[model samples]
Target: METSQALLIYNMASVEKCPETLTAVNASSKQLNCSIDTYGNNQYMCLPNAEKSSLVEFCYNGIMGIQVEGNCLEAKDGRVILHSCKKFLSGCPKKPFFNYDFYKYPACQHINLKHFCYESDPSCQALENSGGFNNVSNDNRDIMYGLIGGLLVLVILTIVIAGFINERRWKRWWWSFTGVGNEPDRKPDKTSGTTTNPGL
Candidate 1:
């Protein structure tokens, strides 16, 4: 069986695990030092695209229906600081951050945007319970494989049955042709008390 691949988790537990500095705006713009640690095993399922020139963090909080909290990033005293975090729908019709969306993963279906928090958060204690996109994908793949395997088995069975029937016919033909220890199709006529062609 093929092993299933796990989804990537962006753990911001420590500075080493997280990006030390990200471009505040664009690659050409000033770099911002990251310090937005919730200190509760900051595990992020999805993150904003760093390639964009804007400095914004997308946090999912389920206050309304699947809200995405947009926290503006600012450089203060040579360090990056979260200016303000606001709530928006998961769809983020305004497109809060540059290409920041959370509905991309199927696992997001089970996770409430508002309940999303640091690993230490009580609401996130059951984070593992939330199914992942890979899990769903793997399930679908397994079902497809099962159906294909069943079809193959059925085809093989049909072929084997056909071969068996053909083999029986072949054996009968061979026995008749070779006449090996088998009676001939024609027998002597008893009424004439002599061996003669049965057809005659």
Candidate 2:
């Protein structure tokens, strides 16, 4: 699965076409650093007008979503382009770097500004196969570690149980580290009607 792709309608909210959608894009005025390509199903998904005459379109069954994130790059010309980054969109509204009213237009909250969704492309599967944005992010890596760590817990517990069984059979002197048999049971002497301990 692509690490990330153009969002589908389900992934986002309130769908509409913005011919002036370029207002939502931020190219950093720098050259596009990354050049990864994804294909929609039979047809392509959205192509970057900015990326020469490369015609990228979507081909997933119906219009699911898109992966490349862009906004109204051509919004100024009243023509819309979906190739903006809005890299700063996460910590929006609550702590906006540049204040813009997002409540009225939540999509306006896109820090990459140029963020938009599109129809699903079956051919886009090619892009999906090529891999997504980058190696698993640090947060995702942490989650992976956690899942692995959790699974390892079961292994640890199984080892512990096995150790207990072995300890019972062998009576090892070094089996105390796990605190498995820390307490010794006290038995009452019927004749003396008194209690005595073994470790003492």
174, model 2: CA deviation in Å?
Answer: 23
After TM-score superposition, the amount by which residue 198's alpha carbon in candidate 1 deviates from its true location, in angstroms, is 19
In angstroms, how far off is 157's CA in candidate 2?
3.0
**What is the TM-score (0 to 1) of candidate 1?**
0.27
Which lDDT tens digits does candidate 2 get at residues 14-119?
2232211323222210122212223322211222223222222222223323323333221111122343334323321222221111122233322221222211
Query: What local lDDT does model 2 show for residue 124?
Result: 32
**Which sections of candidate 2 miss by over 4 Å?**
1-120, 129-135, 166-200
What number of clashing residue pairs does each candidate have, in the order they appear?
Answer: 6, 48
Model 1, span 115-138: residue lDDT tens: 443233234545535655544677
TM-score list, all predictions: 0.27, 0.26
Candidate RMSDs in Å, in order, are 16.6, 18.0
lDDT of the candidates, in the order given: 0.36, 0.33
